[model samples]
Target: MTITARDIQLKQFKVKFRGFDVQEVDFFLDQLAEGFTNLEIDNRRMAESLKNAKIEIEELKAREEKLKRAYQELKKNLVSLKDEAQSPSNQNTSRMIITEAQRESERILAEARTRVERLNDDIQDLMKQKEMIDDHIRKAIELGKAILKNNDCPTNYSEDNDLKVKHLRQIP
Candidate 1:
């Protein structure tokens, strides 16, 4: 059973001869009861904190929903305004709005084109880098093949020197 400091304080014992010390038992019980009381208080405080946090979260969610609804309402109003402006009775204003919207659309298109061009340029740069690396790899492979071929061929130094001298004589 749950015990509290007040329960310990209000406890009564019948006095009898040769009975166990009542005062010592009561003292220990009081200490244990006080500890239990503090633990209960702490548990209550933690529960309250959790409740507040949940309440705050719910409030934020409600506010977020309200803002989303407002945004949708604003979008609907903009559509309505556009429709009203396009009515047959408002030709001049409708034409003006159409022209402005077209200009804005063109500007947005131009900006998108510029961004696409920049992205394309970056892609081209990466392609060039990849091509350079491939070329270097091909050159290294060619050099390796040349080295292997040279190792297979036994060269006569005297014949090579004579050929080199003959080539020099033909150079003039």
Candidate 2:
């Protein structure tokens, strides 16, 4: 049966010959009750403390898991970085690509320069031919005007007859 301090304090005993004194028994019961009350209070405080400690442990475990995940992620990143730093072929490949691009640009520039030079030579030849043709036409017109001035009457020297006779060839 559950007994409280009040139950211990109010306990009674039967009276008999050669029995224990009431004051001594009552005094002992009071001391025992007081000690039990203090022990119960101490036990309650300890239980509360234990419960709080368990909660703190769970929180610490969760934090530890989070830290572990973060550490693993960081480790993966570090490994990739190390691989990049250790590999020389990737850098060489980039340099090779740049060299190829430079060579391609140089080849295109050379082809364009050659084409421009050929076009300039063709234009010079065309201009020379045009000047020669203009000189021939001017000479032909001047010679015809001189022939008309020297004739006494309007001669019947038609263009078709003159060309058939090659009259221009007869002139200088």
On lDDT, the leading prediction is: 2
Q: Per-residue lDDT for 1-172 in model 2, tens only?
A: 5555566667777755544456655765676567556555655564565555556556655655665565566556555655665568676655555456556555655655555455456545545654554454455444433433325212444324445256546665
Tell me the alpha-carbon RMSD of every candidate: 35.3, 63.0
After superposition on all CA atoms, how large is the RMSD of candidate 2? 63.0
> Which 10 consecutive residues of model 1 have the lowest summed lDDT?
144-153
TM-score, per-candidate, Cα-based: 0.38, 0.46
lDDT of 1: 0.53
Per-residue accuracy of model 1 over 88-170 as CA lDDT, tens digit each: 78867766765675565556556555554554565455456545544544443343233223233234412365643453344
Worst 10 residues of 2 by lDDT: 150-159
Each model's lDDT: 0.53, 0.54
